[model samples]
Target: MGKFGIAFTIAILMVACKEDPSAKEESKQGFRMTDEERNATPQVQKQPEKNFRTFTNLADTTFIRLADFSDGFAYDLRYATENNFLKEKVYDCAECYTRVKTAKALLMANKEFEKYGVRIKFFDCYRPNSVQYKMWAIVPNPQYVANPKKGSIHNKGGAVDITLETLDGKELDMGTDFDFFGKRAYHDMTELPRKILENRKLLKETMEKHGFWSTRTEWWHYNLSGAHKDKVANFKWECE
Candidate 1:
């Protein structure tokens, strides 16, 4: 073949070898969206679960790094910085660790949220018991912080402090910020603005449907059903 013909052929082959953008988008949103997502014209199709760690063959009792399994969710991880109510960096690094069951439920819930152009953005997850001690030392109040002696669901890798954010990372207002201790942060605070109420409702209803129960005091806190029975864990995640 002439040089011109060979070059043209090579260009066509390169085009065919290019990766599929839509498929990448699917990974960014985890696999499969709900029927609502499909009816709303989901941007990508659900591919087989291979690229990340799957719950298959794993013990639901095991703790796992959530971000290691999916990149779809956003993370603020306040305790890793001095930005939280503690005002001290309790965690050595920012990470979201949770039991297998909680992580699976979160993934399923996120898929539903994605259907509406939003995803779960976590402020905290699966806190080490040591950090709980640190928080208690600072606050030492039963109304605000759970007693490290009894250990909260967070110490068991079952609870997560999260909020909803758009796919592009714009946070949905829920009347207050993370660790906000007041009536305004209460789930039953109906005096909030209509938009804030709707945002909280979306978060609460979706999380509840996924087997999570919200605490009355903190709108962002959700505990997985049956997880309170798990032993409190103190292992910390490794920093990269």
Candidate 2:
């Protein structure tokens, strides 16, 4: 009777041990992940393949797409949209093209801004002289739009309209919106809050360090020191 009882107890214990998968895994020194968990991955965007041209052979005055050089910069390209002061689209499409010298300086300045948790957000970049005429036809004011006949530094690919934006795309207050024609938009205006002044100062000072100078009338406008000599280009960029 005792031997049969012992055999029956051993058989019952063996069947009970097989019920738990986790206990089996513990014995095997492993764990099992659910199908969903095993396949889970963090979402990431693949960077576009760059076919950028080298700056070495290009002249300082050569025109180039700023995005071709670096993806770190941001662009608004207001003239390419109706949101600008003109209330009409002047550019065929939005693109930031600048002289080699201007692009080089901006790339460097943006790298510096990155250290401060900011980056440059362009409203406008190089302006074809013909687009200047289009803007003039809309505003036709020297204070607002440059005269097409004489041309501005923008026509020479030496100028850019920009502002500071946090790395997450939050725009810093610069007292007024881009192309706001008033004393508030003036760089010398100090009626603004300290935060606005500091933001503007950062932009102006860093640009100056990069060989760009600010215009007195528009806080967003800047010109490369020696880019006025380049011919005023009338060609426009292709949009697809």
Please report the candidate that would top lDDT against the real structure: 1
Question: Any idea what lDDT model 2 has?
Answer: 0.89
Pairs in steric clash, model 2 = none
CA displacement after TM-score superposition, residue 111 of candidate 1 (Å): 0.5
lDDT of each: 0.93, 0.89
Q: What lDDT tens digits, residue by residue, belong to model 2 across residues 10-125?
A: 99999977768777775686767678976999689999887766698898888899888888888898888889877888777889999888999998999999999999999999
Clashes of 2: 0
Model 1 Cα displacement at 25 (Å)?
A: 43
RMSD for each model, in Å, please? 15.6, 4.8
Report, for all candidates in order, the number of backbone clashes.
Answer: 0, 0
Q: Which ten residues in a row have the lowest lDDT in candidate 2?
A: 25-34
Those runs of model 1 whose alpha carbons end farther than 4 Å from true positions after fitting are 1-50
Q: What TM-score fits each model?
A: 0.78, 0.80
Candidate 2 wrongly placed segments (more than 4 Å): 1-52
